[model samples]
Target: MWRDLLPIGRHRGSGGYRRFAWTAADTDCRAWFKAQAEARGLSFELDRNGNQWAWLGDPLAGDAVVTGSHLDSVPDGGAFDGPLGVVSSFAALDELRRRGAEFARPLAITNFGDEEGARFGLACVGSRLAAGQLTVDKAHELRDADGVSLPEAMERAGQDPGTIGPDPERLARIGAFVELHVEQGRALDLSGDPVGIASAIWPHGRWRFDFHGEANHAGTTSLEDRRDPMLSYAATVLAARQQARLAGALATFGKIAVEPNGVNAIPSLVRGWLDSRAADQGTLDTVIAGIEAAAHEHADRDGIDLSITRESFTPVVEFQHALRDELAKLLGGAIPVLGTGAGHDAGILSASAPTAMLFVRNPTGISHSPAEYAAEDDCVAGVVALADVLEGLACR
Candidate 1:
């Protein structure tokens, strides 16, 4: 069903979509969401933190049922990560309405901002700020590669910077949250299932490593004299792979940049962003330590200085037991249950409210790339499962 919707706001010209938060494309997706919600007679409102909420019943202050996902993406992320939940949210609402299902508590769908960390580099920015899990000063201090602060960026987009944190009143409004998303990994395909309920979210964090080396002329510098940061970075990358494999955790040197990137010169100051995830905090720490050891060793060998910065850290989280049990019963106890390595706004929101997630199978076992995929039948199936869960939660 989304194949037709795929190309609507897709970007990077043959790569994929670029709906980073607060940008034109992201705003366009919001417009699309508003149109869909309006068709269902839902009302849209902006909370203090700028998270968009579309309500489905009479306005009440406390504990409303909520569903939906972020609309932001990495530069070339696939179509399904964030928007799937938003669209399928409407789809599920439509399905329930057709079934004549009614709710005692109000229901709303939310579009959390900057879930991708693509534009802001902090995961689940909106939800974290709204929930008070993160400080507003830290939120305002977050900077992009080009040095634009989040506060300045928000002001540029017509949103108030002072209103960006810990909306206790807003947090109190949500009773439960369920996000439907594409499986970012191969868990579901191996189970041979079209849909599964999430069991837990793996512990994950982001670290930035800075390597400083001499910048010198390629022709004049001898091999022994050249202190190339790129060489140290390459060594660190290899060490990260080896250490993670040895520790049985997932570590990636996914994003890297070198200053003065000239082919004719030995580069100075290569940077690496390491994303390490594992089943628990211990393993995550082990993996990170291993990478740091690699950095120290390489820095000494290459005659470079190194520094590490922690961008964000999220511990593993378990879904609410009673709510998950209710969903399991609705699915006939046949639905697959699995843990995800990927992070989401729901994961951040789960601490304060009952939160759960539904994952659609991806045949390719790929995500965050152009090749990430989900079959149409599987998408419709996700909508069905979500509708079923919503029905149980709303009418109960």
Candidate 2:
């Protein structure tokens, strides 16, 4: 399964995946998922919100034990971030069948669409829509950098956007949802464990900061006479780093766009997106406030106008204690329980159903890049751990 998927969306130059939503690469991934389901003789399904499912038992059966994760990637993302969980899901099922496990409840594996939000700028769009955290009207308003609307993108991909909305009944049918993922950090590695259980997800958000100033020729404009938004933007970046360090949070200006993007021209507007997270809400709020204050001060001093808009925000999510404890108990109480600053579909679905996550060891703790990785033995451990959990949860 991993070999079949390794080449799908990989870029030659960067050696990273670019499986953005609604694109041809994403199309190939969806096809692969369908093929996997069919090969396993699982009943395949595509939910209204574009999520794919493969069922091993009755579709209408209540209290279904569902597992799996998304297959999309961020810009030049690593191979393991999303696909690891999905591949592990299939492998776990195979392991369970080999053990001749007798199921007490229906079981399903899922591939939630647009999970990374590389195209739409909103993470977990598919899961959020199903959970009703995102409204239909707002979903229709989402557009990409190339001016492609979400519905239009779905239409181009041969999916019905009209049916995109909350499905409480579908969510209600799920008794428990477990997502196994490669750890984004080194928690498991540091603890000398191959797999661990997620306790909570930190509060996190993305904010867009726009600095407006007069555009001019870079060569002709004097240092004192030019109103450069880039200057204000640069200062704000430093301030963000400083404030986050002080508050023990995380902040990054990962994406940016500049008007008149030329080496010879001073930018008229600098638009930067800030990704921030903290262990708790109060710390996150304080860090963002400090960063915003610093941005305003720099903009005011530079005679530039500044505006900030929150693109997305997810509060801290504590995994269901019962489910989390059950996973630990099934894993023999040796696995460590840890919290993360990263967000996942498990966090988004936690409000609608009992949700938990398992993290595989990452030696370098690197993610969202080509360098992200998990050792082969650690991956096998993760699959075995997932198989054990599923057996405990769904087997008679």
Candidate 1 ranges with C-alpha deviation above 4 Å: 1-5
lDDT of 1 by residue, 1-396 (tens): 254456655865757778776777777776776777777788888877878889987646576889999877887888888888888988888899899987878899989988998877888998999889889889878888788888887787778888777877777777888999999988888989999999999999999989999999999999999989888889989988988898888989889889888989898889989898998889888888888998899899989999999999999999998888878898889888999889999899888889999999999887888788889899999999999988888765
Instruction: Kindly give the stretch of ten consecutive residues in candidate 2 with the minimal lDDT sum.
Output: 182-191
lDDT of 1 at 82: 82
Tens digits of lDDT, candidate 2, 245-347? 9998999999999999999999999999999999999999999999999999999999999999998999999999999999999999988999999989999
Q: For each candidate in turn, give its C-alpha RMSD to the true structure in angstroms.
A: 1.5, 0.7
Please tell me which predicted candidate would have the highest lDDT against the true structure: 2
The Cα local distance difference test for each model comes to 0.86, 0.96
Model 2 misplaced regions, further than 4 Å: none
